[model samples]
Target: LDAFLDAEDVLKVEGRLSRSSFPNSFKHPTVIPPGHHVTNLIIAHYHETVKHQGKGFTINEIRSDGYWICGLSRAVATHIRHCVTCRRVRRPVESQRMSDLPVERAEPTRPFTYCGMECFGPFWTKQGRKQEKRYGLLLTCFCSRAIHIEMLEDLSTDTFINGLICFIALRGAELDMNRLNVFLTEKQCDFVMNAPHASHAGGVWERQIRTVRSVLNATLLLSPDHCATMAIVNSRPLTADALDGHNRLEPLTPNHLITMKSTPALPPPGKFEREDLYGRKRWRQVQYLTEQFGSRWKREYLHSITTRQCWHSTKRNLQVGDIVM
Candidate 1:
């Protein structure tokens, strides 16, 4: 305060001409002491008045027309960061490292064992005289690259549970198949729901759905009828009883369906030659196959770990003590 009395390092302030040497808004040049609260408040007010402009604009507006404080840039940056409008609009830099493969994708399991499930559409279907909408529940396999789809009636919880039961029945014919869904309590099975806004959590299923939608859209344009288009979409050629190596075969891989150019695309990868394994006590055979799958998956996972670029590269890091929306 004593040194400011001599007007050293004095900065112009907006107040009418006054006798104070310390930054006085008294319409004359005056010095502002370091870490002064009044100057910060004034800068904050000016920053907002300028509608959250950058440091350069804020400093220029204040210095050229109003005041010039030491560390003006630092103050303006802080003020802009804390501004409500600026905070709301500012986006944080994305993380640099990609997350490791999720547990389901990394582990070897039966196709459809660990799946990402989602529902879409109330696509119109013709029935007798009236047209009605129907929904679809898609089950995307995390491993073995298989998918199982089921038609749903509505968005009700009962309908969802029923759809799940239908899927288990269709796929688990060899297991102790049961039509009796006699569950005494709702807690018999736990349900996992994805976060409402975090669509990335379900991107795997979303990609499969988008691919299917693209194909369906083009096919329907030509076929025009829902049933016929679906019939063509669902058709898959039967697998032969044996491969040349006498090894058991498996059903169609989702990769083939997702990228197929024609229906009934008869290819060896689509054949499920392991159909004969579905006899009584098929659970034992399934256990053996599951182990083999796990082993093969481990090898593939190791190889993939060495070569990854999808999630590579670092992004700008967030600033410390900075405001975020």
Candidate 2:
């Protein structure tokens, strides 16, 4: 590489190459400069540290006595320390507590489940406007960690019941719905029982929603629409350290969670095979959807419609005779 650079006249030579035998005005070919040599040496040292140490070392460690070569200087050291890949791989200092005690347990018989809804908003398309607010409900079986997502429009009793009914019908063959011991949700009256299955409470689902909010806020930086959509759409389907009781879960995309149920559950022995299996499943789903629905399914199913309702009656319902106030 050095020879090629020299041949191509890319590298500029500086300093004296050799001393002449006779006293002549002609200067000898210049040798490589100290600064350039030092730069190369420092870069080499950085590479060696990264290669041998496995985990990267700091600038101070590179400059320490045994590893230090004569050519390396503070300036060159600083340059190598700013290397982008090295910076990415470097371990940050542990500034916070490493561990904490577990919180007190709730009643054991209370089965874990996640219940929430998401709105599929208007996505930009070549044709025209699309459905901006298709309210959808999600029911997650916490123990089995299965998810069911269904799209709906209004949040009325009929809409909620229809969505739940569709979900139950889909899972009827696979899951024993009666075995579902608890239903969880936030204080949404739809989730809280008005008539049948009157025991349903919002507590568990409320807590789960809070947890989803917290995780999304912490990871995605709390952009409202993205975070809310992600929290509902990506529940329990994907494995995560946060959800799986691990230190750091892999970041999951919404598409991954949505399409997981359509794929097979067999575990591959190796990472390569697992990835290949996932890819095959994804391609197959795309093919099946395309063949079954044709190309215009997006156009047909995703039309935009809006509605407005008054909240006067809703507000009046809250006005009651109070013991205090």
Q: Number of the top candidate by lDDT? A: 1
By summed lDDT, which 10 consecutive residues of candidate 1 come out lowest? 261-270
Clashing pairs in 2: 122-132, 185-202, 241-249
lDDT of 2 by residue, 64-169 (tens): 3223233445544555465555455663522222222112111111111233333232222222344244443545543222234455566665766676667655
Candidate 1 segments whose C-alpha is farther than 4 A from its true place: 1-31, 92-98, 173-190, 221-252, 255-325
Error of 2 at 106 (Å): 8.8
lDDT of 1 at 86: 74
Error of 2 at 56 (Å): 60
As for model 2, its CA RMSD to the true structure in angstroms is 23.6
Model 2, poorest ten-residue lDDT window? 101-110
Which prediction has the highest TM-score against the true structure?
Answer: 1
Error of 1 at 223 (Å): 13
